[model samples]
Target: MESNENILEVENLKINFKTYAGTVKAIRDVSFNLKKGETLAIVGESGSGKTVTTRSIMGLLANNAVVEGGTVMFHDQDVLKMTEKQLQDLRGAKIAQIFQDPMTSLDPTMRIGRQIAEPLMVHKGMSKAKAMAQALDMMKLVGITNAENRINDYPHQFSGGMRQRIVIAIALINYPEILIADEPTTALDVTIQAQILDLMRELQNKISTSIIFITHDLGVVAGMADRVAVMYAGKIVEYGTVDEIFYNPKHPYTWGLLSSMPTLETNGDELPSIPGTPPDLLDPPTGDAFAPRNSYALKIDTEKEPPFFKVSDTHYAATWLLHPDAPKVTPPVQIVARQKQFAEMQKKLAAEKLSHPVEEEEERQ
Candidate 1:
């Protein structure tokens, strides 16, 4: 469930990396809030700064990276201002990260149980016996079977899906307040991906931790996220609720993302893809970062960057198309069709609820 209370708030966060060639502006004025116990999905292309933004929150930015401006406020404390020791204490104990590759995250030399228990011993000052006991319980909670016996097994002993579960178990062992999942399911098979997603949802309900899921897959975002933030060329181009983003998207980049997602009804020889590449960050565009790729871009988009315009109290998009004086342009045909489909589904669900009020009441009980 979602809440009104913001557990984490990022404001005007600008980040850059120093390279031999030049400075790479990775994150530019990116801001979003993660409500307590809510899942916020950050969606974008490869270099759209989805990972960078989350990494900054975890205080894992590279040494060459520069925090040009802004603040990441977690529990009223600015994360950027925290020292290395403070960051070390904050991570794992209060905030945990689950990366995409489980192989890299887990230790090959250590047994699975020891790996999971290490955090408890270091952070919570638990005895080895107590930590191992907690590790076993966590493994079971994450759906690992025969945990008492298999705890002694090495990382290589587990399958890919099992390894990922172990990684998740390790992350949740301490019941961290916030969980940063950076493309956690990208490496798994489709079936395993679904299982992992289901497990995450179940665990979230149990733990009540806020999640920031970073991924390029809009399909995954649609299912997992309570709210969506669409990033493009180091900036958040659109921010809205899941329903608003999927059914009433206002940004061209968002439309492109939605259009590219394949559906059961899709009947094309080739899937639709966004026309142009993402903007180069070494020397970002003078105007709108998405101007060159946006089909309905106005002259103003080429000349000036558009501020986020309010579509609703909760929804905002940065695009010249949202300007009142700009010519009206509808979303792509596929996107419009998807919106209609979603509307029909909602109507059907509403009708079903009205028809089966008794069942609904019983279920509530």
Candidate 2:
């Protein structure tokens, strides 16, 4: 549990896109809080508004988009209400965004070092010499080899993983307090994905910066997040600590997400995917957004929206199943089996630590 001094707070956040097709409600009443130095993962399938929600915070939406309602409060200031000058002052200074694609985010013509140092020079009034020096250090910190020499290289000179690392270096160069990473690993290979995630975690530890990690990968969420928010059709269906989400999920949508997570045991025989596609946001169903795909949907879930029912002090879920009159139902067996396996692994590690206290102490040291 983090302190009440939240680093970022989104309350009733709504984003709508006016198109010839009609107004698409990409985000509806989306609310969450990111505490200082904590990682809050926004997880969901494609078109679930995971990226859009964070984009609203960064004020990076397209021209057709409009924030219909809600407030984005950051460090005691409502960013949604801030003037363009104030927002510009905050961006790349107090906050930085890491796009999913390194190729798109990086400048092909600009030298990597200059690209990294440009934000510092523009926002922090840093001298070119000092900023370049700091940029080399940041590249090295992010695992670039011979960073001092490689600093002058262009984006094309670096490999895919290296380019991604360079992008991360630029995002962190300004030492922004809030880092928004939108599917940062989606473009990388599995091995590189692990490396990038590890680098992000290490950087977070060193800087004590808060992270808003948006990804469709449950595996990424498991490894990186302290808390999880499951979104469906522009709204959060479930929000809780990582443990609660993985072990005791209350929403059927969340259950589906956990069950569909790819595992080694799946043996490449076609990963188990969710049954139905996400609902159309432009003309969503009358009630719960997940009701169409939810196997355990009740009548109320289809006809009337379910309020977020408190499951515990820290966990809450929006589902009719949480209603007092709803029948007791257990989560799917696959999720239960996975949770058991995870618990056993934890137990084995705990026992190993107990039996080899000296090794554990030495490792900690």
Candidate 3:
């Protein structure tokens, strides 16, 4: 059951990567929250800090990376302030992540059952026999055929989709409070992708764990997410409920992302593409990073960064176009003449009423 209670809240997160070239400002003051028993989909191009943001939650950033600021509050405690021991305790037992590729996620030498059962032993201190029994049951739960016989098989024996299923089984074995699925269906075919998505939805209903779905495809997010955050240049350019983002998008980047998606009605029409590449994060842009690509760019777009303008209680976008003084009204001739006609008619009627006050009084009587 979904609730207004937030399971996790990320505020003003800033992460920088130390590179040979220079410091890369990967995440720039990004903030969003996930509601209990809901999916929050983060959509953006590659290197837009989608993966980095989730990794921060897991305390899995690289050695060279530095977290300059912000807090990831899971329930009451701040995840950022946790020690290495605390993060280790938190990772699989409370918050688990599924990587993109299933092929690389599993170990070829290890038996599939052992890998899945290992988490239970480590986290819950369950005996080997009990953990294995639980793992077998989980395998069956994830729709594995003839699970008793197949539980001992190696990771190499399973197909792409089946391996992904195993990965999910491991992630959910601990029943983590939050699941971070980093494009889990990206490698599978359309049929398999649908199956995985359906399985996730089913699991979510059963477990009621909040999910952070990271994907570049808006199509995937439409049915999956309760809310959506459209990211660009390491920042959330727009944020809203799923319906609001799809039907009433306010940001130019969101518009471009939606337009680029292939619709059923897009029969043979050329796909619309957003012009210009993303800014170099090594030296970030002064104004709006998307100004070069935004065709509706105003002078203010290049001169200053636009803050998030509230479209509704749940929807907001970072754009100067939403400003009231951004555009001036210049009424067309036809509209102006129509307004003049109405004014002249009201004046003529008033003059006649004054000239025949007795007649007006008699009519009223």
Candidate 4:
């Protein structure tokens, strides 16, 4: 559930990368608000600007990248306007990131403990001894056993899962207010992925930090996100709560995403995939970015971009299908069925909660 207090707010963020051929419009007029202590998942295919959007927030874009316009407001401070020194101070201290590959993130020559303690030593200005102690504690917190002894081991000495845990430790060493995890579990196996997700959930509850989780996997989004922002062609096509996104998705791109997920009840051998390729960012379409690929796209979609239409108090979608004059179109059959299943499951959970309210309260305690 999202709180009333917003921790970060990004408004009309437009980003472009300079290249030999032309300027690539990576993120165009992207806007979203993240509540404190809530996990917001940015779900989209590769090259959809999910990573770039988060990178903008971290102020970690490449040298050729240009922030055409926008404001990334964190704690009332405009991050885009911050000096290089200020950004340096904020990164890994107030805002930390966990990259996709642990191997690249960890140093091959450095001891794992020292790598984890470096953030503390630099950001918190703690002594070597104290930082080492805190790093060991963080290692244990992230489920790395024998941390005291293992801390001396180099990155090559640990397994992939352990390396990721070390990366998490490094990210959390300073107890950052915002954690950006860019496809953190993509390289791991299913079992390790599940464990990592559970560990993150537990840690988030303990630290009460806001998270911006970037991923292309809808299944992962379903389990982790409190709110979801579905991006397409560098723009957010749909924004809503987890339940709203899963049960009542409004955008065609979102419907395509949900349909592409493999379900237990799926009878077909092959999963349904979205037709057509994404539009080229170098020459972005004048109207809706997704208009070319959208099967349900109206004439207006090709002529003009649609404004965000309010679905509910919190739910919004930027698509012509939401317009009053547009013909009603039902979502895919699989999604409708999934929504019903989710509704039933919610009812059962509610009944259980009602029957054992004290148990629930005690469990929370």
Residue by residue across 38-142, what tens digits does model 1's lDDT show? 999999999999999999999999999999999999999999999999999999999999999999999899999999999999899999999999999999999
Q: Candidate 3 lDDT, tens digit per residue, 217-268?
A: 9889988999999999999999999877876677778877877787665668
> What's model 2's overall lDDT?
0.90
- Computed on alpha carbons, the lDDT of every model, listed in order, comes to 0.94, 0.90, 0.90, 0.92
In model 2, what are the clashing residue pairs, if there are any?
none
Top TM-score: which candidate number?
1
**Total clashes for model 3:** 0
Clashes per candidate (backbone, < 3 Å): 0, 0, 0, 0
**Backbone clash tally for model 4?**
0
Q: Encode model 4's per-residue lDDT on 160-276: one tens digit a residue.
A: 888898899999999999999999999999999999999999999999988999999989988999999999989999999999999989989999999999877887578888999
How far residue 355's Cα lies from its native spot in candidate 3, in Å, is: 54
Candidate 1: list runs displaced more than 4 Å.
Answer: 356-365
Candidate 2: tens digits of C-alpha lDDT, residues 97-216: 999999999989999999999999999899999999899889999999998789899999999899999989888988899999999999999999999999999999998889999998
Clashing pairs for predicted structure model 1, backbone only = none
- The better candidate by TM-score, 2 or 3, is 2
* lDDT head-to-head 3 vs 4, winner: 4
Assess every candidate by TM-score.
0.97, 0.93, 0.89, 0.95
